[model samples]
Target: MKKPPIWFWQIALLVMIFIIWHIATSPDLIPPIFFDNEYRAAFFFGEPAKIFNAIWVWFMSGEIYPHLWVTLQETLLAFAIGTLLGLAVGLWLGLTPLASAILDPYIKAMNAMPRVILAPIFMVWFGLGIWSKVALGVTLVFFIVFFNVYQGVKEVSPVVLNNARMLGANASQLLRYVYLPSATSWVFSSLHTSVGMAFVGAVVGEYLGSAKGVGYLIHQAEGAFDINTVFAGILVLTVFALLLDFVVTFAENKLLKWRPQQAETETT
Candidate 1:
């Protein structure tokens, strides 16, 4: 018999998980071993079918698009601003030892501080708007990209630097041709993580204080004790996050094509 492809197994695994979840959560589907009451499972974990139906109804009614758009806007804005700032600061410090040394402790301290706590302050400062969400997200994203870019720049071989200098490469030329390309890889790597952080920041901000966005919807559901709607909101956010990750993967493949393939290296 022919072996199934990887995707087939992947989908099969997903189906199996759903089956188990459905069996566990659906009333009368299986005997209630833990809970004496049949409706207990649905009350706590929620029925998958009800969650799916809620999501379907949300989309069919065109009720989710505006909230989804707001979340995406906040996420994208935060990611862009944070990445640019991180890249600039990383490059400046990585290239200049004195500045790096001077700012190192402050940078470390800021990074060490639990940033989620700043959400309330940001909400106060930015007034429970998208900017507050974006601000929180920037804090989450900046350090990840900054450290990666710094390490990438520092990891450039001295031999390569010396050779470029010997070939009469000026500081500007070297930075443009060498350092930027080296850091580009690290930036892309950090971007995947940053995207998730951006979403988290946005959603958390909405959760803290907002009248709109999926987080607000989830919060509303929670307040009303609507477990299925809460699960539906989470499911929507998760699918969107995966879609954002897919976009990042596509961009990475296209941008990093100049890098050697792992399969080629292994074959060699």
Candidate 2:
């Protein structure tokens, strides 16, 4: 028989996995490996029920919102600033061949380095404030977007460029109508991944040294051996990351209407 849509299979598989997870962790179900060490198993396998309970207590009790808000603020600020900078730099480099060729090695070298390890340096320079987190996030987001946009522009057909020039398109017009549209899809693809990187950067910065944020909350929970709370904070961060990705998808849909619908469907 012909297979069902990918979404159908994906949803079914996810549901099945969740059900299995729930069953495996239930107190009544004892795996052979956990029979001798139930307490350790509980810790390792995790109590889904208690995870939900902890989430309720932290959320319903209004204990987590303030910290969540702080984390969200930092995440969003970093995402916005980083995305804008990436767009500006990417567009400039992509449109200017000479500039791109000149800076290519330097850009690759920087991007190749272990950026996360530089979190401490950012903290030292920006002094553990929101700025440090923003700076770190910017570093993470910039290279991903830059490379994609540059490649996208480079991939544009020479024929298309010639046609636009023949139509009397000025440099600004060419950039707006040709180069940007050419790179828009690639930019969005990079952005979808970059959103998570931005969050990672912000959170890692918080983990290293911060007075607030979800990462800070997770750090505190770890120090106290509150694994449940650590997991809860992670869940919250994941939800926000998904939300940001959805926003990017929505924008991509709107902006790339000219692209083939089948391409979008296949990508999804």
Which predicted model would earn the best lDDT?
A: 1
The collision pairs in model 1 are none
lDDT of 2 by residue, 1-94 (tens): 9889999999999778767766776656765464565456556556666767888898888988887787777777877787777777889987
Output the worst ten-in-a-row residue range by lDDT, candidate 1: 259-268
TM per candidate: 0.95, 0.84
Give RMSD to native, each candidate.
Answer: 2.0, 3.9
| Local accuracy of candidate 1 as per-residue lDDT tens digits, 76-138 | 999999999888888989999999999999999999999999999998899877999999999
Query: What is the Cα root-mean-square deviation between model 1 and the actual structure?
Result: 2.0
What local lDDT score does residue 232 receive in model 2, on the 0 to 100 scale?
76
TM-score winner:
1
| Candidate 2 local lDDT, residue 268 | 30
Local distance difference test, candidate 1: 0.93
